[model samples]
Target: MKKERCDAASGVESIELDATVVATIRFKAVPPQLLEVDIALCDAAAAGQVDMYNSTPLFVAATGGCTGAVDTLLKHGAEISCSVLYETCHYGQAEAVAILLDHGAKVFANTGQQNPMCAAARPGSVKILELLHECGFDINPSDQGMISTPLHEASEIGYVAVVEWLLTHGANVDATDGAGKTSLHHAVNRRHSDVVTSLLDHGAQADIQDTVRSYRASRGKYDIVQLLLANVSNTQRNLTVTS
Candidate 1:
């Protein structure tokens, strides 16, 4: 997961540099003062001077891995629901995810544009997907003001594993968006062939043209045109032979 910013660079120290540390370092284009803070925290951790619950240390550790500061915060007690605490989870910070979970971070707490489960699905992280499920996130909860479900997002983004996981967990294959279009509509419109195949295999309707067809036709897949036509031809043949 990508780190939005490094809290460790703010004159605090954390324990155990993890992915977030790498992320911060990679973003060296940031201001030198900000860079100094991260260096100080990393230095303190290396020197064993940083303690947990210092917001900087906590944010660093919460964004990834088991740092001494993180452990200290947990041992001495810290608010897991801190507003800034959501960044690590939003970026798909797995190790930090585990640490936060151990520290009782609210898994159900909404983060980003959606819940962590949905956010994880966007990145197609199977580990995060499984964790969110284990944490009791609904696989097909009501879309959070989006036109579609998590399946729709995953399929549109070509995240086959996420689409498969959500389906196996009872995500409706034909679940519709606000415009009454299914995941198939999203996959086809996005030209995600794999997602289209997956949705079809799971029984997504092939001919679900909605009101926006005129506007979306340029993007809608022609390959799916063949599939829909084939189904029609087969059905017509069967009807004529029977008649």
Candidate 2:
């Protein structure tokens, strides 16, 4: 679904833009002057020229970590679409994301790139999430009609570092998506023991009932019910001691 939505930014403008320019950027070429020669190419599409499946020159440069092209394009008035940020996150390009944000790129949730924070979390780097945070993107980005917070994405994919980072950075451990299931529920269903432990340690409600989906233990190696009960016991003991 994410790939489909992100790919929606794709289209080609062969007459207005140079194929050589797109190729150079795609292959890691970084001379900014190649762009200066053709200022028309910078914002050829008004919205932002995209080729190779709807990628902007700025976005291509950022994706490949080519700072020069990124700078040149932005200076020439390239569109600062959130789609660029989304691609940078999806590609794990932290510096590129910072460049876009520095150029005043805001996450327009209504765009095709609906959930940039989700893309950041999907890449398994807390740094990208941190960059977005600088842009005022909270731990849980506001829903754009799509389900799953960044926490849910990381939890389902079993990225414990991402899960922990979100929890520390202001994620609601008990927050549910449109599906009415918390990140904890996702982890349990996906059988990510490490992620489940991280969520529980972060004070997720272990006793919260699962109303969306249920799963049976396929193998004895990991027991969901046992894990939840164990956390519940530890929580009660901690409360009693502190009381």
Candidate 3:
């Protein structure tokens, strides 16, 4: 009998398993209210689940300008020093940013790729920039790695108001990026005539050359090229008269 049992066990295949012996799997249906309670009880559980881009629920809420959600997460002890701060700035969520800052988020914190100030520049909102400045961040913080100044970002995107605000805050108009390109170079290259004008009004050097091209010859925008040339000539004439 023992020999016969051993032979039967050896002959059993995966597909030959008895249906009655197989484990049954089932999901219990819960009421919506109960599900909500369960989620609330385990709210901390999903807080650490990151998406493919490594963003958490708080990051999503902050980036979407959801101040209420941000507040709730902060109350739940979510981390305040993550990229969500930069996301708030990037999306122009001034209120969300303020909430994060009030909870001890660093104004100049770098989120691996860009800092809050750099993110704010992309939206070109003077209000956001002012908030960051009021929080004690340097208006002219030195560039790190490949990151450019806020002025460079604002100029490149043609944000006249933001450019003006940065200039008023004493941002270096001639501050260069990794390639030695100044804000004037960015504005002219992107054909933002108004931004280029603003930079020149703020004393951006018209003759500064980047690694590959001078500000005047950086782009095919005729008006920008003409503006740079005229500004350069005027600067030279003023210097000659002074001398």
Winning candidate number (lDDT): 2
Off by over 4 Å in 1: 1-76, 82-89, 106-113, 143-147, 211-221, 231-243
Give the per-residue Cα lDDT of candidate 3 at 162. Answer: 90
lDDT of 3 by residue, 1-243 (tens): 001122244463212111121111001144434323332322343444455555665676577665666676677667765467776888999888888888888644433445577778888777777777777767676435346889888888889999998998889888887767788878877778899888888888876534113443545666766667676756554553354
lDDT of 2 by residue, 1-243 (tens): 001112234564322454555655566455555543443344434226565666766777787776665776787678776667777888888877878888887655334446778888888989988877777776675446467788998998999999998898889888898878888888887888788889988988876645112324314434665667576656554553354
The CA lDDT at 183 in model 1 is 81
Clashing pairs in 2: 9-54, 10-53, 10-54
Worst 10 contiguous positions by lDDT, candidate 3: 17-26
lDDT of 2: 0.69
TM values, all candidates:
0.61, 0.72, 0.71
Residue 25 of model 2: what lDDT? 55
Clashing pairs in 1: 9-37, 9-38, 15-67, 52-69
How many Å off is the CA of 206 in candidate 1?
A: 2.3
